[model samples]
Target: MSSTLAGAFGIAALFVAVLALVFAVQALRAQSGTAKAVTELAATPEPQQQAQAQAQPEAKPGTVKSELRRLSRELEEARTELRETLQHLAVVRYDAYGEMSGRLSWSMALLDDNGDGVVLTSINSRNDARSYAKEVKAFESDAKLSPEEEEAIDTLRKEASPTLGNPDHQ
Candidate 1:
């Protein structure tokens, strides 16, 4: 019963707060003309009080087209540079054998904008360690790829640019 009474009081308080807010807004809206004039003046500067804005240099005729052409050229150059860079990389580390500890064996995939690049695998052993490289083209390999190598490729593909070779990869 006490809880129900408290809930009723809480609801009444909320209703009073909402009613007060509505009245406050109405009172502000019903202010005299002088108060609104003062508010407008406070919010905006007078004509003479306006600061002299720094003027941008006027563009010459045909400059818009030329500027657009220049920007397009620069964009193409950036895309070409990105295509040559190794943008996608994934490193997979695992234990080669039950005896092997610390998971030193690793396979890494290094791909460019296109899914064309190399996969490097290092097999570690207590006695001796060896590394191998395989070429990948269009997310595939002409030569057989190990399970680790395939995993490396798949990881890089999923995490790399969704549009692999597109200009918007960046």
Candidate 2:
């Protein structure tokens, strides 16, 4: 009986030890996660946070609301500027005529967020070179576009799309 009781006690102790080890490991993981979060928070300068906090008390609800509103306004302004700015551009080079062997002729498309801009084309040959400009609206031109001019606009459309992650489009 005594041996049996002793064995049971030993088994209970082992169980407790394993439980403690598991708890210790969980605690360490939690601590590591907390430390990482704190480090990330500290990476930002205190002055900037303080500047934001200075506008109102750190604990005030109004301050947080005001800051959010200001940030929202700034973001809208930036987006507006980005849309109005000339952000899309492309150039297409091709042979102007079948007789022209060299790809000396070229077309360039420049556009804004609304696809309002101009396409410039320069046709070159042995005899003479001619350049012309056409207005582009909503990615389409009022004047008839040559194949090269259309290709230039298509290139700009592909490049200017947000999925391209082109900084110039931004």
Candidate 3:
């Protein structure tokens, strides 16, 4: 009877150990899932998080509103200045002379958002090169434009539109 009781106690101890092992595995799995969730949350960017990440100094309530208004004005001024910048550009290369086969001559158009800028052309020959600049206003030039120069301007206009047609169409 003593030996039988000892064997029964041994079986109960084994059962308890198995139960503990199962619970430990479940807890580890739960902890890993929580860790992954935390990592994902940190990786995602929210506006508030970005502001905090920038480490901007805290401002008084009234000052914050005034600062935002000043920033808004500055942003508008930057946008207006950008419109006047010559950001649109295109180039056309062709053989200007019948004897020149390498197509080294080229015409380039540099324009702003308002289609105001200049077209520069370079005519290349074996012995010499000639360069010219024509002022453009509203995509048109007071001076006569060569075919290559006109093509360069047209290319920039087409590129500015989604349909690759007239920019005014949309």
lDDT winner: 3
Q: Write the per-residue lDDT of candidate 1 for residues 1-170, one digit (tens) a residue.
A: 99999999999999999999999887777555436544543465433223311233433545443344345457768878888777789999999988989999999999987889999999999999999999999778888988999999998778655677665555
Please give each candidate's TM-score.
0.55, 0.51, 0.58
Distance from true location, Cα of 135 in model 3, Å:
0.3
| TM accuracy, model 2 | 0.51
Which regions of candidate 2 are displaced past 4 Å? 1-72, 159-170
What is the RMSD, in Å, between candidate 3 and the native fold over all Cα? 14.6
**Which digits, one per residue and each the tens of the lDDT, describe model 2 over residues 53-166?**
466554445543444445645775797677766777899889978988878999999888777789999999889999999998878997999988999888877765762334
Please write out the lDDT profile of model 3 over residues 1-170, one tens digit for every residue: 99999999999999999999999999998778666745643565646544653575544555433344355457667867777779888999999889888889999999987778999999999899999999988888999999999999888777755522233332
Ranking according to TM-score, highest score first: 3, 1, 2
- Score residue 73 of candidate 2 by CA lDDT: 53
Per-model C-alpha lDDT, please?
Answer: 0.77, 0.77, 0.78
